[model samples]
Target: MQPKLPIQCPSCESSLSVTQLSCSNCSTSVSGNYTLPLLLQITEEEQNFILQFFLTSGSLKEMATQMGNSYPTVRNKLDDIINKINQLKTK
Candidate 1:
């Protein structure tokens, strides 16, 4: 049977290479450690907001309406989330 691909870090979408496994996938590579991006470390509320925005194909007007908030408010929240994600990449 074919083996499954290595697990990926939720934050960066990078593969997680473990050192070992009991099955035929043993002897995995042990390279640098994988760290989750700070954005992924953010509060669940923020993550959910971002997820919803993307699921709606980045429709800010729709997001604002669905969230019962002003356009500026939704825009600011999105900006904050983006800034946080950018910071993660810079690290």
Candidate 2:
């Protein structure tokens, strides 16, 4: 599998734009500057949390139970993720 592309620079913390894309099956290529979706900009840990949240039927209580944390903690994390997405959208 291809590795996940970096959306943020590690040094300056700037956004990275995609300049090239190709289909592995057909080898067809496309080139342009493309901004990754906001979802892709978040950390892998946050992505996994999103997956876990969906797998648990989007229940904060269930996520807390699965993660051995409190419901408020899970809710806060979700809130932070949402707020970050919102901020990114406004950019």
Candidate 3:
């Protein structure tokens, strides 16, 4: 499996910025400081939840059933993610 991107500093636990990117096929490299997208800045679990939400056609009931969680639980999870996204947008 591919390694996950490290978004936080290992020692300080602060957010990290992208410093370089490379083209896999051409071996071309680009270097610059850049912030990760809001979606990518979230935890992987949150990202997967968002993906699952879309895959289920944005149906909370379907998501709850698929996750073996109660409807309110799934709804709360979605609400939390939405709040996080909004907070990120303001920054």
Candidate 4:
């Protein structure tokens, strides 16, 4: 399996930069300082949540039902995710 790209440093919890990239087909490598886009910096769990939320037609009630979580809980999680994304944008 291909290793997933990291968007943050596990050690210090700082945003990660994509310094090197390679072509999978021909093994060509490129290196530079590159910042991970804010959207891409979102955690995998958040990504899954976004996907599921869209799949459920943006209905918090449906998300709660699908995840077996309370409606308020689902809403709160969504709010928190939105806050995090907004914070990233301000930086």
| lDDT top scorer | 3
Better of 1 and 2 by TM-score: 2
Query: Considering summed lDDT, which 10 consecutive residues are worst modelled in model 4?
Result: 34-43
What TM-score would each prediction reach against the true structure?
A: 0.59, 0.89, 0.93, 0.84
Q: How many steric overlaps does candidate 1 have? A: 0
lDDT of all the models against the reference? 0.74, 0.91, 0.95, 0.92
lDDT of 1: 0.74
Model 4 stretches astray by more than 4 angstroms? none
* Stretches > 4 Å off in candidate 2: none
Q: What TM-score does candidate 3 get on C-alpha atoms?
A: 0.93
Candidate 2 displacement at residue 25 in angstroms: 2.7
The candidate maximizing TM-score is: 3
Ranking by lDDT: 3, 4, 2, 1
**Candidate 2, 37-62: lDDT as tens digits:** 88898888889999999999898899
- Give the per-residue lDDT of model 3 (tens digit) for 1-91: 9999988999999989999999999999999999998998899999999999999999999999999999999999999999999998998
Superposed Cα RMSD, model 4? 1.7
lDDT (Cα) of model 4? 0.92
Model 1, 19-74: lDDT tens digits are: 43344466554545555445445667888898889888999999999989999999
Candidate 3 clash figure, as a count: 0
State the weakest 10-residue window (summed lDDT) of model 2.
2-11
Q: What tens digits encode model 4's per-residue C-alpha lDDT throughout 24-49? A: 99999999998787778899999999
